[model samples]
Target chain A: MIEQVADPLPQTGFAKVVLELEVNNHPGVMSHICNLFARRAFNMEGILCMPVAGGERSRIWLLVFEDQRLEQMIRQLEKLEDVLAVRRHGAEHEVFERLEDFFH
Target chain B: MMQMTGAQLIVRLLERQGVRTIAGIPGGAILPLYDALGGSELIHHVLARHEQGAGFMAQGMARASGQPAVCFASSGPGATNLVTAIADAFLDSIPMVAITGQVPLSMIGTDAFQEVDIYGITVPITKHNFLVRSVEELLTVIPDAFRIAMSGRPGPVLVDVPKDVQNQLISFTDFPPRVVSDSLPPVDAEAIEEAARLINEAEQPVLYLGGGVVHSGASALAVTLAEQACMPTTMTLMGLGAMPVDHPLSIGMLGMHGARYTNFVLEEADVLVCVGARFDDRAVGKAAQFCPRAKIVHIDVDPSELHKIKRAHVAIHADVGSALEALLPRIRKSMRKRWLSHVDSLRSRFPMQLPGMDDPRTHYGLVRAVAAALDDDAIITTDVGQHQMWVAQAYPFRRPRQWMTSGGLGTMGFGVPTAMGAALAEPDRTVVCFSGDGSLMMNVQEFATLAEENLNVKIVLMNNSSLGLVYQQQNLFYGKRVFASKYGAGPDFIKIAEGFGIGAVDLDQAANPRAALAQALQTPGPCLIHASIDREQFVYPMVPPGAANTEMIGG
Candidate 1:
């Protein structure tokens, strides 16, 4: 049975890893990334997305745990037609952390 | 430049993408698009009773031919109905293009009649979605939709076109050929060498194959790797047909409801080489405990799978076929005789035994009868239930794509329309659908479509008079308080088929169900075999929810 797990990913890890993606700005690109993780039952701790300067592309920052699959996930992200480049960051990456602080 | 309506451009682009058929039901909102489609000789539109059936039919074609299949739906309820099928396609990695008509660009979000934000609703389900605001945007969007649907772990893509856009007259300058630049990045040589080193070093290794192996067309390469390395192999449910079921080194399916021996072998494995598979929770219960001793070497086309559950000692992010091809040359040839013998002993200790294999009145017998009746080349589609699980356990699927089921979504009512889709995709080959009574009723309306089109789909209904899977789950967990699961002696499926002008055989009264099934199989054009099975019969070797694979019950 290969359906997406409705259950949220177990909340335990704190060492956050951030992946910055530059992708073609379209309705479904974000869904593709979210769905991919959802299928694997992986959780995205945080997400930040906005249109780039030309409105032709989007920049997405995905917050996740520092899991082993991170490198491979980046490789898969690079494969999408909408996704142009992916860059990684360590726990100190402020996008999600700052958002969490602001919410707090 | 030729002036044409947006609807005309959409149909023209579909023709360029080599789409010959589309499954859909026209509604008031989508009239413009349907109007354009009405005159197009390039595409044949199969009118489905429900939008969901249309979606699944497209899925069946996609799964059969490995090409992007198209489905159409109008706004609101029509678009919502297609969601389940779209989600199914996404989870299963089926390449599908679902085109839904919006009310109009101006009317969107105004709570217009039959208008819904289909693009927004489909965000989590589709690989990508588009809401075409203007006619000109379609020129690039339509072709891009096809390209996205077919490339890199193919999945469903949606295009929500408003009525205004479809009717708008626009000058079209260029219809560029759909180009998918699928240049896979170079494989990591160091990773390959490391994986080869681990393979050569491990004494008790197991080769684990997943759906990706089948998706990448690396089954032959997988077999070669297994034989050369003398590694015992086990498949995930999705990876059932990755290796021929009878291969000596093939250890059968693993995880929940997996072969008892196969799970034991996995427990004992020193090194696990997983290709084209994510270590799903169902497959590897208690992820940390699974293959604890094994140094996992995971090779897959999708990067998200590696270390998602079990951390890999070496992870290669490349297509399964290419990864295996590169690693095959680097690894040494040696037989793990002791490991093979250990696996053999495990197999002998807990061999698979389906109850009533000899009796034609039972579920196993029905499964066996259908398998025996159909030709080896027949494509089998199944709905979600006990029947589906039983089919997985008993069916001797020889190759990939031969066995198509909703693995990820576990969607019911998938069998009938998908079988029709498969039959339509490969008109020469026979298509068989194994459905339970509960699942069959979900999209029972499609039976008419099957009859009208005269599709070469033979449906074998396992009428147990209950939601067998739900009933089984209730028995296991809810203390047998069967709630809303039991459908007592439902409608006569044979009569229903006859109503649709399709041929049918009732095996309930037949003295020999196997013979009756064989007769039904040979019957021409859209037939149904109604086989009544014991409601109490349960699928065996079921691992309780969250239980380890080794802790399965009732084999």
Candidate 2:
């Protein structure tokens, strides 16, 4: 069997951005979202998820580099049936900035 | 108020959705559903030898009827076996629903016997998937599966029902209403107007059709648009039957293995109207170089596809049928005499050459001979490889949904079972599958299903005793170091067909091959017509992988 190794460290040059997504809270929703990024080899630097709308929907925040394929990635993410809405923000978004110390 | 087990409710819901036939195999986990299906007079179950075969059979029905079809499999290996067929349907955008029986909800995470994570496995492949947590969820999940499969861009969906859920009793006042496709995404009138203006203004515009045309049932409208605008039209492989190959404006399939003149026409196009077709790598070689000179007008139902490849000057996000209907009134009739004459000149210079079209023993000849025996009404399918490309080049497909092949997934074992599915859906039409020797063996076990069903499906076996496409690629690009492509010894396919209780004929030994072929096809309930093609014969007018469409090797 072929062994899958962890993805190498993301290339350092590109600027980072944050993506906020509203999704249907369900068991496989995370799998669908993660599979898209992994299959495309698009790296996600940091991620967070929490239920909103009275536990009916989940909000996910993703921190990643703003590369050429980012626009295409956003379009793909929006295509997911469970994904209700997607909002893009620059690195200044407080959602990830507040959690920076936890990662370190 | 009505009360029923989950399995009984599933059967009733499927019947309400107008599913007359289901292809599947019953196993331990799926037995409850099978038992429910057994009691239904409206639905007929086709017992396929393999789960993969069952999957392709559902695909075949969906491809032929343009409606979502269903297939069933049990847990573990049964569900695992179904992965390829589901993937094939997903890539081709065929509407299908695959229901698999899982271990009881409690045993899902544990390594229970005959259990697999099919819902998770099929996530990347299906339009959507469901893991039914309760009997109540079945009411919503079943209808939702059909809705998701048929709405917008059609694709396969999976509903994984735990064995316990199948047996669980649920009470509801009434069943949910049978589903239909979701309302189409609103069309951008401004984008449509701009696209029309570009086509009307450009001197040399090519209309590129894809599988979306067939899915939207807009083939006639597409042909009309091509004629009104005096544009030469080219089809992707999946879009073969959208325009009759012999039509005056038709340029045949474009890109890899396309006729030399067809790609040349695309090279000179001032504007490209790409409708309902994604710019797949095989269809558009080297994306940056494809239609470099042309401004693109891309119309599709999927918003993600509009600017994904070859940015569209005017991107219309709507149903192909609706978008074409809007554009027809805006387009002006033009003679395009100079451009047509240029195309004609190029066509005469570099026509698709068929070296051995007269002799029934040769590859091209065999495809032509089959076409001669059958009319445009016959449904034609092919397994992947040289036989598939050869048939794509030579077959005279004149109508939409008349040609079905694995275009995106290119699964090898697709031909036989899919042909059976088509025959099952449209029992009146004679279905023919053009299969290579290697592809035939992949799902040859399905011959038994064909014999049992006794549908009119003919298998035209092109026996070369090798994986022809790989051998050709090795010869052309890999310095002729052919490895593991050729068979050292082959089975007697004639005896194998007979063993499977289907009639077989070997054209190699026939005194009159054409007469034999015609007889087998015309009198076919389920028949295998085998002809031995030369191992050396290669599908030509080939574009080496990643090369521009203009850089072809041989014909």
User: Highest TM-score, which number?
Assistant: 2
**CA deviation > 4 Å runs, candidate 2:** A1-10
Off by over 4 Å in 1: A1-53, A58-83, A88-104
How well does candidate 1 match the true structure, expressed as C-alpha RMSD?
3.6
Model 2, A24-78: lDDT tens digits are: 9989999999999999888899999999999999999999999777898998899
Pairs of residues clashing in candidate 1: A2-B407, A2-B408, A3-B408, A28-B129, A72-B303
True contacts kept of each: 0.19, 0.42
- Residue B423 lDDT in candidate 1: 86
- Candidate 2's TM-score reads 0.98
Q: TM-score for each prediction?
A: 0.91, 0.98
Candidate 2 C-alpha lDDT tens digits along B1-555: 899999999999999999999999999999999999999999999999999999999999999999999999998999999999999998999999999999999888999998889988999999889999999999999999999999999999999999999999999998899999999867788888899899989999999999999999999999999999999999999999999999999999997899999999999999999999999988888787899899999999988898897888998889999999999999999999999999999999999888899889999999999999999889999999999999999998999999999999999999999999999999999999999999999998999999999999999999999999999988988889999999999999999999999999999999999999999999959999999999999988998887888888897
- Kindly list the per-residue Cα lDDT of model 1 for residues B215-257, writing each as its tens digit: 7888999999998899999998888888988899988888877
Clashing pairs in 2: none
Q: DockQ for each candidate?
A: 0.23, 0.36
Candidate 1 docks at the CAPRI level of acceptable
lDDT of 2: 0.94
